[model samples]
Target: MIRQPFKARTPEELISLLSAVAMAILAAIIVMVLYYGREIIIPIALAVLLSFVLAPLVRLVQRLRIPRSLAVVSVVVIAFAFIFAMGSLLATQLAQLAGDLPRYQSTISEKIQSFRETTAGRGTLERASSMLKDLSKELDKPKEAANSLGTIAAPKAASPKPVPVEVLQPDPGALESLQTLISPLLHPLATTGIIVIFVIFILLQREDLRNRLIRLAGSDDLQRTTAALDDAASRLSRLFLIQLLLNGSFGIIIGMGLWLIGVPSAILWGILAAVLRFVPYIGAVIAAAFPLALAVAVDPTWTMLLWTIALFVVVEPVVGHVLEPMVYGHSTGLSPVAVVASATFWTALWGPIGLVLATPLTVCLVVLGRHVERLEFLDVMFGDRPALSPPEIFYQRMLAGDPTEASAKAEEFLKERSLGSYYDEVALRGLQLAQADAERGALAPDRLTKIRDAVQEFANNISEQDERPSPKVNPTTDVEATSAIEGVAEDAPYESLRVLRKEDLPSEWQGDHPVLCLAGRNPIDEAAAIMLAQLTDAHGLSSRVEAAGALSTANIFRLETAGVAIACLVYMDASSPAHMRYSVRRLRRKLPKATIILGCWMKDIDPAALESLREGAKADLAAATLGGALKLCIEATGVDSLGTGAEGQISKITAAS
Candidate 1:
């Protein structure tokens, strides 16, 4: 066997390979900087977040006729003072907690014994222990038997016993002792100092920093850069502020709950929880561990521990699910997976501090991606919004031959839109994409067949839905006044044909199948015709669908045209007007007196081209959407047949035309 050497078939392939390699290299470099330079970056990140939290306060103080420098100083001083007070209180509580642990030793021992007694019976643990004992006895029997049988070895000369030795240095003087005591604190003090300095400068020179960022990002697109910055700042500020308040509230509630439950050092646990909750996902669990362990040690019975567990289980969910969503609205805009992945990545690089800052940092990246075209992949990966639009998703699902998911998507869309609009906006557009791909020869025959089958199945699944189009008031129209009317407002956009009832259809259209929907030449054309027939049936006009082959010169005369009042030739790809004209002529010959309407379901079709096609086909009317076709059919029935209620609507449709 021989392997062929790799070669680029086109410049595009080579460029793509090079671009991917460059991106990988860039990512590796970024990771290295994040890991090695975290000490510097961490402080800056903290300072930036702190600045966001305090910006509103600084502005508020400045608004009260104070100097900007004074306002900033005042806000920063006040904020740090509160944080310092909390820190001192936490330290005191922690010291007390440590001092009290020895008192609970007896209770802890009793609980452990009780737990062991309860689980000592024939379970997995007990069986494993018994087996280990038997194995140990079996091994020892060999040594004992050898000794009993007097299987002795020759004695060797006695070895000398080694003496123990110890080495000690002189005791340190006071200066050395003081240096030793303070050495461990130096790093933390230095880090704190850096953070404070950064925060002060960031707040004082906020505008300067923003301008520098904009310049670094790009001065050419100032508007976009400014918008991105504003979006990021506002989002981060709102997130930080709300998180602070919610976490603080959570702590206060936990403290009160623990106090009521008689847990030791409740206040300490509460403050610890509030601080740790800033870290994502597992923070609450870590915070709960301290109090739960204390509960176990402090109480003889399991009541305290159970109560503490219950407190966390109940409170965390309520705050996380109910309160947080209500307060944050759309949240930090990072996807759940992005949040977890970022937490792991940043923690690996910078430890606990990175974990706490992960969400805020990822938000910045997502915002940047949203604004910068080159970095848009970041937003698509990390942002909470769906990456693909409805039409693209539908097309993808169709190609994958998953009609179930495609139908699900359609059902969701139909919740807010009428079936006609959904077909026009999503299904038809998806088929258009498939048609385009097929025309370009990019799709394999099998893939095209799968798409066609999936689309047919999806259309069939949703055909039973009620077709009375949902009345949608135009944005410019007064919704209140429109709602006050008995039926759909005349000024509202006509989504589909409206009939008072099935009985209200004209005598000519009263038969079991009054509308004939004929597919055009394309493979997907039958799917479009099916959609039109479904919509037509929904509006009280009974409809039947026929495949493109039914319109052939040989098969045309055999199509059932009896009692058919309207005939619509449906085309997914309407690029060739001559083919559409030929199909229209065949349908006209079959149903000579029937109203012939050309249904060209092309998105954004040029008006002149459509009119020319209609004229060339000699179609009574042409529609560029499923909704328009249904409307044209309804109009052909005449306003008198639909009763007085539909007169105004038909008149408006005519005036618009």
Candidate 2:
């Protein structure tokens, strides 16, 4: 019998099917986000998330047998205290900076006017806002008339649009005065409330929350959900805590620099350095530019301005690249492309608060994916490096290292099915060349270094270019940067952030420059300050626990003195060629730091690492409570006897009571 003619899917049907799936998913996500946009939304989301990050901490504390309530309180308290102290420090600086607003403004205005006069195309003693306003309205008469008629029925609300942009200015005492008077009242109360409420709620209902989760999910679902929550919370707590520590380092370095330079609000600048660090590429530039502008406004010498720039060159990368990525690695698993896209998407959708929540939200997505399976697609999309078996990886590593055996073993280790056309060609070419060279005895150590270095240079070129804005697109799908991702770079001169520049510079900066000092509620500055101090002290560790329980704060060279103090931050990256050379070039500045002695040991950390650590800490603290986790970090880093046995106490209580 003849078979009936078969019909295939038409192009339209295929398109329609795909389109409907996409739209349905989009609509559902938007509806969910909107439905729970406020109130329990942040908490519920944070609870599920923070739990995963803090799971490790909870496990640690459970080992101590301390009451869960007490453990959480301990973690919360430590986190809050660190944050509060930082806030206060930044507030003091911001107040100081604002207090000097008049001076800062006057100087900036003068500089603007001078530039405007010098360049015919630039400006004419006019503020940017006023200039833009005039230009916008110059040809808008007809449009204005039309707009007004359209709105004639009533009127649009005239509230000031919130814009966080504020120009840098010189201030003699405005910030100090404001801090002395106003901040003491407002800052403490608001900060205190956030701390108290967050801590109490997390501690009190934690068990109930866990039980509710268990009830909502069936056995398998319950186990998976609990595991997911525990993992995310523990990791997140550690990440957040690490972030705080890193940021604090940045603030210290920056503040010291400003202070030594006789800049009025060193503390403020330091804090700015720390908080701005959260914004990635953009933040570092802003932080660097601010202090440089201040230095230029006050100092008559071009040398000092150059010094400021030079210092930034070092500071930005040291904290941004070297320090951050160290402990964190690519652990967040988010690709650079995914990170920037998510940040931009969330910022557009929910503003600054959303920007702060973007990474955490992404983390939540990854965790959720582990449970639902469907969402795991996102985890793969966002991750920097694909996960593989360790033993298989080690075998591949050995194979590649041999060069002679690399060709035949390519698919044997990498997998035949997984290779894309592009990847297949590239791998074959590379391995073939290596194998041939091995046969010819061209695999000398020198040649290996040369090829490796060339690869690195090519990669660095890629990374620098990757910073450009991406093509605009809907936020529904993954947006990745490159197929071959680069390793994190080296950190620069956070030490100079703590350096004293006035003494290092000509007499003009000391006497003739108009010092503009102001302050505001920016936490990044505090971190910069801490970092600056750490750099100068010769020993790079910042945590009290790391420094044998003594708060090591000496010589953390502020900006003024950092040029001479800090030598370099070194690192190693095997994942990408761009990682090594770019980092070395960025951190070392071609001129090496003088070795004062033979006994000094220095280690470099990637700045990305700090944020990861902070996120981990915060998530852990929120989910599992903090006592055990904090103790673990302290003990891990070898902090003085804060009493490690407490973990056992906490764990015993969980089981017995």
Candidate 3:
């Protein structure tokens, strides 16, 4: 027998496979380029970030009537001059600290001796040390015994010990001494020079560079390209500026606190804190280490050390958690995990500088992902925004059999929206998706059953919540709310819906089981009916839900319809309007006096076709959304307080009938 080759089932599958392979290869190539070219790229990346920080300052100078060239030159020089002064001050502080370290040696020794005494006084350490000594003695006993035996057995003359030889080279002259002194400085100095040159050129030619980037990215879509660039620039600039301000303020506070706490070189520690904190997560820890060490050395009593520890513990959290968020306001657009992961990745590729630049670079990637068509996965992966919409999330949770999370999501959405709106916009749409999958034969029976159970569970969880918007809140009348309900038939206009209070509803609708929500065919339809029933019950009208089987010929006669004022037939799959018409006819026969409304959750049906469906089914009205069906039920209650638009729509439909 011969084996057949595997193949993609569709063009889309084949294309997706090829595209994924291409992306993986592209990613590998990019990583290689980044790693191999870091010597050249690192300096340029630093310069670019620096330019973003300094661009505003240059613009400010230009606003003062300075020429562009002069402004660029002045800003670059001033910025670097300030950096140089800070470096010099840091060096001076370091030299002084080093010189003063010898004075603390006695205190350090005393501390060490005290620690040793404390540990020795504790029996645990002493026991471990004594055990090691005994073990060594036992192990050496055999060797010593052998040596004694050899000596007693008239061992040969002791072998002469070889003398040790040492080799030395001549001392270095002035050139070599200078080379030795400057070798460590050469890389940093060269990098600084390259960065300075790059920054100056970038600031001078910023517009030209932006144009080139736009052309390279997408000249045909100038709007998108410009927007992407503008977004990236604005975000990067804001992030850098806010971070600088916040970190600087933090450092100042830390310095003052450390000084009051009697820590040595508080100013130096503060500067280090401000500078090092540009590296995310671990920067504050590194910055605190120096001051903590000095605190321990400067004060033998441990008071200063404890104070320094407390200072960082309290101050860093306040700055990072409180101040940064308040100031940043989603400026970075990077998730916390993305920030850390990008830091690790870039640090691997470009070392420490990459750690500092990770967030800004990832921000550019996110902005590009948001604006560019092909790179959207980057935003989905790294951006702080939710990757999936509410309906998709709800559907996915149902698929995962997580009713709790689905209910939680519904509750969260309900905080700002009525439960009816949530059902129309989120839950019903999610069920529609399930219906689509089921129609496509993609959903297994057991999986469908799980989804049904999950939906039912979710409905039960939030059933008690009021369906009306809070009195203090103004209800949303946005077109989006209506359009979400209408699904794909956006051209069909919908009337504004309002859930009426129980007292506001007519006397007939105030009775028990005024509305009967019957599932059209499947469990998905049943789930949708459950939503409608919840909505109707939440509003003033009493409602009950029955399965599709309950509406079968055998069970139809058994269903109690004495108090049912309205019968809402729900069909998640409305492709076969014949079946819906049949169901509607059956319900009409059972409840001849009750108003019949068809709730078609289908996405593709148009208004004309829906009206045709309603008329052919011999139903009084039809709606594509839960909200619409609920509104129809409310209007059926003979309430006149509905908005004029709603009343007009009801009148038009009634007259047409």
Candidate that beats the other on lDDT, 1 or 2, i.e. the better one: 1
Q: What is the Cα-based lDDT of residue 256 in candidate 1? A: 96
Over the stretch 514-632, how does candidate 2's per-residue lDDT look in tens digits?
11111001111111122222222211122210111011123112212222322222111122224323323322332244211000001122334433332422211110111111122
TM-score of candidate 2 relative to the true fold: 0.44
Better of 2 and 3 by lDDT: 3
The 0-to-1 C-alpha lDDT of every candidate, in the order given, reads: 0.78, 0.45, 0.78
lDDT of 1 by residue, 1-657 (tens): 899998757989889999999999999999999788888888888888888888877878888999988888888888888988988888898899889888999998898778778888757887898899999999999999888676456455688999999999999999999999999989877887888888888889988988887776764888878887877777777778888899999999999999999997788888988877876688899999989988889889889999999999999999988999899864677888999999899889998878778887888789878876667899999999899888889889998989898877777776666677677778888888888888899888778767767877887788745443234432233222211111111222344234535565668877888889988875678878888887776666788988878888888878888899988887777678888778888787778899888777776786576777788888887777776676666666764322234332221111010
Q: List residue ranges in candidate 3 displaced over 4 A.
A: 1-14, 119-123, 141-173, 464-469, 473-511, 549-555, 604-609, 639-657
* Candidate structures ordered by lDDT, highest first: 3, 1, 2
Q: Local error of candidate 3 at 55, Å?
A: 1.1
Q: List candidate 1 segments past 4 Å from native.
A: 1-7, 137-168, 219-221, 466-497, 500-503, 639-657
Evaluated against the true structure, the overall lDDT of model 3 is: 0.78
Model 3 C-alpha lDDT per residue in residues 1-657, reported as the tens digit of each score: 999998647989889999999989999999999999998889898898899899888989999999999999999999999889988888898888889999999998999889888888577878898899999999999999999998899968989999999999998999999999999999989999999999999999988998887776765778768876887777777778778888889889998999899777778998989887877788899899999988878898888888889999999988888777787663367788998899899888888778777877887789778876667899999999999888889999999999898877777766665566677778877887899899999998889878878888887888755433243332233334222123232222223444455676666676778899998888888888888887666555788999877878788789988778898888887577778777777787888888888877787577777777777777777888776776667667777424333322211110000
Query: What's the CA RMSD of model 2 in angstroms?
Result: 30.0
Model 2 scores what on Cα lDDT? 0.45
Best candidate, TM-score-wise?
1
